[model samples]
Target: MGRSREKEDAESRFNSPVSISVADSSVSLLKLISILIIFVVGVVIGLVSSSHIDRYFSFRADQFNIKNIYFAADQFSSDSEKMLVNCERECALSMESFIRPLNLNHRMTDDELFWRASMVPQKEEFPFKRVPKVAFMFMTRGPLPMMPLWDRFFSGQDVDKYSIYVHALPGFELNVSNSSVFYRRQIPSQHVEWGSVSLVDGEKRLLANALLDFSNERFVLLSESCIPIYNFQTVYKYLTRSVHSFVESYDNPSRYGRGRYNRRMKPDIRLTDWRKGSQWFEIHRTLAIKIVADTKYYKLFKKYCHPSCYPDEHYIPTYLHKFYGALNANRTVTYVDWSLMGPHPATFTAVNITEGFLQSLRNNGTLCSYNTEKTSVCYLFARKFDSSALEPLLNISSQVLGF
Candidate 1:
């Protein structure tokens, strides 16, 4: 009986509820600790990821905002084709009077300014006998691969008939002085944004810089990809004899075009006074000065325009048409193929470029008429060429185009 009691007691100890309770408590504690660790790690990762994304978007938004301001200003400045006659006088006279103080003050203060520099004359008589100097204003993002071809064109018999001014990106640090063509030829430039009012500002800035020197009679704005279809001599002769400026004007009714004309342009208070055109142009020195000096229109444009509508296309054309309809040939010298509809024009490919293509583009009779006798041959420059077309153009420079 004593032996049986001892065995039963040992079995009872093994089967007790106290031992089961201890095991359950240990498992529950382990699960809770595991969940805590996972939660902590997840929180840390989420915070770090959120910070990175927020920083990236913030940078983008800042850039976007700056660009928007520029576009709005440009749209506000452009004039509408329909309103050209009514707005031209206001654009010219108002802007000139507004900027006169700034110009006169700058002239009085700075000896190195453009107007002062215009007083100095070349020791040697001007080259190209009868031809006036054509100032090729290069508005570029970087080194032009086609510079060599331009070098050849400018290097022709009468080198002094043409001058080159490079308005490169502000941060592009390269020794341009080494090249004879670009020697002492750098103009002050700011960062230019695509589809922004900054482009109009940049162009105006370029005009101001050119006008300071005064020797630049004809100002032609060319991009990095632009190649001269005719030699410097031909271009110089063409410009000097021409009576009118080459600025394109068209009736733009698109949402981002003339349709966005501000209702708030003071004094006039009419939406019909706005306009639009291509950004490229060849302006006489008189027009260049008028543009730089403009204040009333500039203030109005800067105030009411927006990014939804691009103003560069309308500003110059509208302003020119309004003030100097007789001065402008009413056509752009730069050829751009807008057959393909998009924000950008059709980029010319290597395969598409040929002797035949060149002839066709050159012969295209889109010239604008001023009087019964004179016709301005429409396109002096064509753009958006693939970088590859450079070599072919160079090879045929002499044989094909006389450049």
Candidate 2:
């Protein structure tokens, strides 16, 4: 019976569901809780890591942006300051040129002495000096092929009333002496480059050189290609009788004309007050002095103006407008055509040189204004003519144009 009972117990134990111990159940529960804890910690660590990565990249991007802005601002400031320094140096050099002659009169050579003596202000003399000579200041790059033509024009009956001053390129080795018209009459030569501030400097230097020994009452700036369309008598009479200086004032909205503005010339002056005009001009002795004597306006212009920012187009116009608006005639004696788009003026070819064209150029409207008794005569000189046009211009000098 005992053996039977043991077999039945074994069968029951094997067939029936087994009962787990409390200790084992507790250990399994503890292991499950520990696993859940580990999973939660890993998830938290992943989120934190992702957030840190995003913040680090954002900070780097912001830093890069700031550096770019700072670099741009610094570059602009540096350029502006550099321009200012250059302008100041130029002005000082001009003053030195003017004053050196007066201080070192005996030490200077004939050319230098002449320049110095010319700058010295002459005391107002008795009854207005005999029609003061007009100095035709010519700025040229090479030999003026139109020399023969100019000779004919200048050799007119009243040619004695005027003198010629040629500012040729220093490096040019031309035989100007071959022509009596350009004989030993060359002024001190200097280097000049187109589309550069040196152009402005060259002009000033020419004026200074001419002023040195010549007692010119009137100064007319002209280019190599320029030709007189009127008789010498008419031009001289017109200039001597003029009451105000002649300089053209026009609106130039291009990068070169507009870029000359600066914050340094503010409050008292504004960009809107800025103006532009032809590089050529005709002025009285008094106006010439005013230009040379200027310090404040010149300093401001040179600093803020450049090649991209053509100070030449702005400097003279702005200074004259600001200081001597009343004295200015508000018209340029030099004629230019900006109708065709290019870096240079419209060139008149041989084909374009006709009697009609010459007549049209000489035609002055029959209108009267301040100091004008009748019609307003147009420009004294026209430019950008090809060297070949010299023959056509000379052919019609006396018959139609009266030069």
Per-prediction TM-score: 0.65, 0.66
* Tens digits of lDDT, candidate 1, 41-105: 99999999999999999999999998886676556644433244344445556633332211211
After superposing candidate 2, which stretches have Cα over 4 Å from the reference?
1-122, 126-129, 156-160, 177-179, 250-256, 267-269, 364-374
Question: Looking at candidate 2, what is the lDDT of residue 59?
Answer: 97
Candidate 2 overall lDDT versus native: 0.70
Question: Model 2: per-residue lDDT, tens digit, 380-403?
Answer: 788877899999888888887786
lDDT of 1 at 343: 81
The stretch of ten residues in a row with the least summed lDDT in candidate 2 is: 98-107
Q: How many clashes (backbone N, Cα, C below 3 Å) per candidate?
A: 17, 2
RMSD in Å for all candidates: 22.0, 21.7
Best model per TM-score: 2
lDDT of 1 at 3: 91
